[model samples]
Target: MKRKLLKFLNRMVLSIVIVVAAIALIVVLFVQFSPQFGGKASKEAIESYKNSKNYKDGVFKNTKDVKLDMSLKDMGKALMGFFKSQPNTKPEHDLPSTKIDSLNIANYKGDTRLVWFGHSTFLLQTQGKTILIDPMLSSVPAPHPTLGSKRFSQELPITIEQLPKIDAVLISHDHYDHLDYESIKALKDKVGHFYMPLGVGAHLLEWKVDKNKITELDWWEETTFNDFKFVCTPAQHFSGRGLSDRAKTLWSSWVIQSKNDNIFFSGDSGYADHFKTIGEKYGPFDFAMIECGQYNEMWPDIHMFPEETVQAGLDVNAKKVMPIHWGAFKLAMHTWTDPVERFIKASKKEKINVIVPKIGDLIYINSLEENEGYKFWFEGLD
Candidate 1:
């Protein structure tokens, strides 16, 4: 009887090993060939990544020391929170958006007109050039269709095909929410140039974007197109599209300047000294679009609360500031309208001009007075 029991135990262990090996093999194949997983930096690109000042050991590092790795307790909280849903986490009604037409775009001779397509997506038409920033117009924010949050609204104000030839596309990082596969594929043929931080061009290259048009810059690097000068600034965030490639690419804020107008875009950052530094370097911005949503205390080092968002605007010396990174998807546990409400209150206290435009509504930064009275539009929804 003892001999029989030993033989049975050995067979069970063998079966378990075989199953584990098969699962490992499947995961390897998935990561290897799946287009959804995206392409890693090429050998040459990896060498460039290594040479960056921020690169240490094998990963990129934030200027200030930060811990990107979550504790096991925090991980436990996140995993448990996944099964629970927050009230008013998504909009109850379909949000309104203005229709965009080429004639309207061409005729607008005003100061930089920006159309926000919810969250961090913006279409800025200024000086006869159209720029698309963080164009994640996909319905979902994950690499796989079945795994992420669907967009709050049913459709975008303008489709990718309807867009005019894009002068440039700026990507902040390699997170799935910011750098979407579907949106990149749609814009690949129409974009004139793609600008991103170091090591991000790998994904674009894999997606068939022209290498000549792709220019990857390190932090503080500036590139020019026509009258506008685009500078890659710093942000306190991490980047990775998959499990194996965390922090392989850089994240950033951006400074766009022309002779007349200066704009700052805080891509995704926590409250940090970088904001003050940016303001001192390039002060009195005409407008600053700052991230103000999808934040929780659990990961306070990456995303900022709404109040911090306003303070960052003040830090950057923005004449008029707009809160973004909300309204599109619910990536955190906060109430859906919490971000804007908190932002408005904070802005009032700080005595800063706040621009609250509806999705797809065009707000000229030079004329923010016309964009007021949008208060409580997002209120009363559960």
Candidate 2:
């Protein structure tokens, strides 16, 4: 009887070992083969990054010290916080939005017009060019579909299949929310070009994007395509798509100048002097889209509060501003409508011209007089 029992115990141990090995193999394969994780910078790209002042010690550094987490213990706590149920983090109902008329967009030949698709995504039509800014239209903004929640709205302004051929796609960084793999895969063949901060081109190259279609720039770098000038400017932010690749790429804001309009996009940034610096250099913009959501005291050094959003708009010398980062995702613990609410109040106090438009509404950058009629669209949806 003792011999039989020993034999059975040995068989059980072997079975356990096999199961563990299988799980390990599955994990390794997923990490290695998944396209959503994005690509890392190649050795050649690393060599080029060495020339950048911001790239040091094998990572990109923010202009100021940023505390993403206090330590391993704090990171653990933050992880726990994310999993815990929080009230009012998301809207109780589907948010309001308008549908994009493809024919209207294709035929648009008037002044520069923009349609916000929420959470930093915009269709910028100007000078017969249709550019997409941070076009993250995926349902879940994570490395995998199961890793994140669905967007606030069940529908988008336009489906990928219906989107018109894009003149260019501008990416601020490689964060899953701002740069989505699914969206890019759908857009790669249709987009005329992809422009981004330095090192981000590595991911595009990994995704098999044609090298000729990609343009990467360092901070303060300027490139002109079809007479429209694109400038990559500094922002107080850190970037990484995975644990091992933290800060391997750069993050930044952008300045878009066309023949008749100047636009600024504050891609994710903390309240810092970079705003003032950018203002001094490219002050008095015709329009600016400032980030105004997804903030917490723990990571205060990276994201701006709504009050800071207004200040950022002012610092950039924007004649008019629209809050862009709050409408689509519940990335923070605050109520979904909190960002715009606070932002609107601050703007009124400062006497700043702010356009609070419904998502997908085509907004003329210089039509401040007409934008005054837009109502507080999110009033009852919370």
Worst lDDT run of 10 residues, candidate 1, spans 370-379
Question: Which runs of model 1 end up more than 4 angstroms from their true locations?
Answer: 1-26, 106-110, 370-374
* TM-scores for candidates 1 onward, in order: 0.92, 0.93
CA lDDT scores, all candidates in order: 0.87, 0.88
* Predicted candidate 2 versus true structure: per-residue lDDT over 128-222, tens digit per residue: 89999998999888988787877999788898888878999999999988999889988999999999998888888888899999999999999
Model 2: number of backbone collisions: 0
Candidate 2 error regions (>4 Å): 1-25, 370-374
lDDT of 1: 0.87
TM-score of 2: 0.93
Q: What are the candidates' C-alpha RMSDs?
A: 2.5, 2.7
